[model samples]
Target chain A: MVVMSATTLGTLELAALLTVARLGNDAYGLAVRRDLTERTGRDYSVGAVYTTLQRLEDKGFVTSRASDPLPVRGGRSRRHFTLTGAGAHALREAERHTASIWGGIGTSIRPEPA
Target chain B: MLHVTPRMRDCIGAGARARVTAPRTESPPLPERVLLRLGVDPDFTDAVLGDLAEEYALRALRDGAGTARWWYSREVIRSAPHFLRSSFRYACRYERVRLAAFLGALVLTALAVLITLSARDGPPARLAGASDTVIVNSREPVQLPVQVLDAAGHVLHITGVRYQWVSGAPLHMSAAGRVACEQRGDALVRASFGALRESFLLRCRPIRRFVDWRGGLWLAVGDSAQELPIRAVGVDGTPETMLAGSAIVRDSDIASLRGLRVHPKAPGATLVDVWVGGIVDVIPITVSKRVSTSDALRPFEFFASPLRLSSGQTRRWHIPVGSYFVSFRSDTAASATAAALTLSTVGATCSRFGDAYNYFCLAAKDAALVISAPGGTSGAREFSGYLAVRRN
Candidate 1:
């Protein structure tokens, strides 16, 4: 496949990568907690940004499954998440396209020593 | 019309505590009074409600709403597990010794219950017969005292005896008068002419063949084969009298039967004098090892107070052997000057047909006594009964 170069992607694109890779089908507040902890080596309480998952779902990058009510979790239904094929395609295209643009740099502004 | 007035609004300050110049942590009276009138502000109302609910829950649990409250509090304290974190961080904090001690106590409690049940089914002194009643003869009536007497002239044991006389061979009066068998009410009295006061339990043999023994005779006694053992006694002053006669030795026919023996411990707690005879075997045991208390009586709650033994004073007692059957007797004043008191074991409770005062206790085992008496002046009172050792 011919690699196309692209650069300067939005924060939304990086999030799309995380959702598609680790949380292919079943993901939600808990999955996001695991993914963020794995990627960043630091824990973030997922309660801070569950609304973002809903926003992503609305934007078509992520899909959600309303889970059954759990007793221990205070009868709250978990909204599970999954990244669509379109989401994965967007992420891979972002990565390869970004790498291609970086590869196409003819020369550095600082000239090479003779 | 009733929107919070400016004064009320100002009084209900923001969620944060209002600062004042005073060093003491006292609320300014004017602002406090205003806030009381307005109640809590709506902005901070949710937090206040939450705090009140939490306090209410805590108080309900601490006051003991019962097991359900305790179970709920136990569950709520547990935190959600962090899957990324190691459980060892929490597990290592528990004390090793405390966990082991709890398990050890539970095992000991279970062991104690098992031992108690096993000890309850131990063998009795002896089994007299397979059935409750054994027929001795076929034709004539017979009479014998169900109670047994010790050599010390005390009643030691009591049991029911039945007799059936055959048609042809009636229990006849011998020339010596030492072996005349006759029926007296329920007892078959085999009175010997030479022997002082002793007889044998006569139950008719099925065939009615005359079995001749050297010295003794069988005197069968009972109202009927079905009647229970009658522990008949009469009290005269300090001692209870067993109206029946004592035990005597016949030939091997009655000598081989195991009979109960009574012994008296000397005042200084020394040697014991054996009362009943015909004990072919004797075994001495350490009294300390033999003495035991009933589980129910060990925790008996005794209260001390002045009391009187009324006319209807009666109490049932299940006492052990080697325990003194003590009864308190109130003595009238010797003169007008001094108070006189005396207590004694007033009855013979042994096998020998004599005084069994304080002798109701058995040897090395539990005995059931039904004592009925009026309550008397309560001080620290002590009673001792039978001390049972193995048959020698």
Candidate 2:
């Protein structure tokens, strides 16, 4: 049987995938949110991070497993996420597509820094 | 260790001062309460509250308790809507499946309860017997009354009845069609007639024969065939006094006891005369002395001293309170002298020698026996003796 490729990732899904990739073995709900805030300079809610991660998992872009409960987290387990091959390919494809679209516009526009 | 700069030291001091002055108020466990009130899924609520509390604690340590509380409140409020929305969506997605499962479980529980009630309250059984347990003597047969009835309380006559023993032996129907128990032990008797059947337990107890002393000479009845056993009941069918060491002569022909000696353990004991096998005999002798608590002690060899005693010297040994029969033997150059020794809480002294010495003494608590050689004796003396203490 022929296997169809997974569909394109949404903005939050792509961001979550990249955050999981950057987090390596430490990718989880709170960790990914922290990394997203650090990179994007915007605090993301824990719900958004978890929901996007769950959607990524459904899209086969990421997989998750529960870690043992930690006392610091009030004895709650961490749902750790990992990027799959599809997720990595999607990231690379999104990057290449963005680069191609930017390649056409190149240096023509200058934006003010925050 | 890294050196602390002046600015860092100042900042640390300020932070310490702030901590020292800050009110030691604990953050109420609000996240858990919020999750409970919102009816969030347990799995998600725990992790969410944990993450919030962990971050809150970190911020509290770094910035201040007030800032930490504000941050935590904002995070909780911002995340509440998202979490609620997601949880609602999840519930909606699986609502049908969960409802189906719950309804299935309810149906199964109702079905189980219905079956149980039906089994318990259904029509009354046709055949029923009285007394699930029947106790009878092994030599005697017990008639178990059985009644057959319809659903309405009317008695139905049984055409034919059959009895069978599920356990034990010699369980049969007598010529009159009654159940006969002839052996000792337990038997499950099941009676069946037509389509109706019922079962009951039969415990055949063996007749106990006892031979004990009673007023005069009386035969006692007991529950066992123990030799010299105290009779639980006398020949007059009255409860007999239980005694220890009472002579029990079972299966004795009284007519042949023309020369039998009736020795009472003590005065005031009544000799009960009973007839066994067409012979007048005294089998159960009820003693007047109630068996004392001290009688619980079995006959035991209390003390046996192999040490030799010299003249004018005494050896004392401690013994518990009880009745003891002591026998002493002394060996001198002339002959081995056997002496009866007596010792009690009160005054009692015996120095006689060269005979069977049987002295029964009642020892008070912490009583000791003092064995001494006669002051006039001057030869080498080796003394050895044993005390037979009677136990209740």
Evaluate chain B of model 1: give its TM-score: 0.18
Residue B366 lDDT, candidate 2, scale 0-100: 59
Model 1, span B1-392: residue lDDT tens? 11222212323323322111211211122322232222222312221222222323444556644442443333222211221011111112232233335458868999999997665443223223222332332223333323333343344353333333323334642323222323221224333222223334443332222222221111112111121111221111122112222322223221222232322111111221121111121212111112233313321111111223333343333443353323223433457433333222222243321243222223334444333332346653332222222211
Lowest-sum lDDT 10-residue window in model 1 chain A: A45-54
Error of 1 at B357 (Å): 18
Docking class of 2: incorrect
Per-model i-RMS in Å? Answer: 18.4, 15.6
Off by over 4 Å in 1: A1-13, A16-18, A21-41, A44-51, A58-60, A67-114, B1-392
Best by lDDT: 2
Which tens-of-lDDT digit does each residue in A8-73 have in candidate 1? 235544653475467666565655645766766754433223434434444455665656744323
Give one digit per residue, the lDDT tens place, for model 2 in B1-392: 12221211211211121001111333634653554344234445555566676677788889998898888777777777666654454443354344446558979999999997665433335766656866553243555666666676556664456676666656665522365444455677787777777788766543334444332332222212223323443334454342112233332332112223443333122333443212233544432222233224333323334545555567665556665545554444443453322233333233322345545566666566666655444565544444333321
lDDT of 2 at B184: 51
- Shares of reference contacts reproduced by the candidates, in order, are 0.00, 0.39
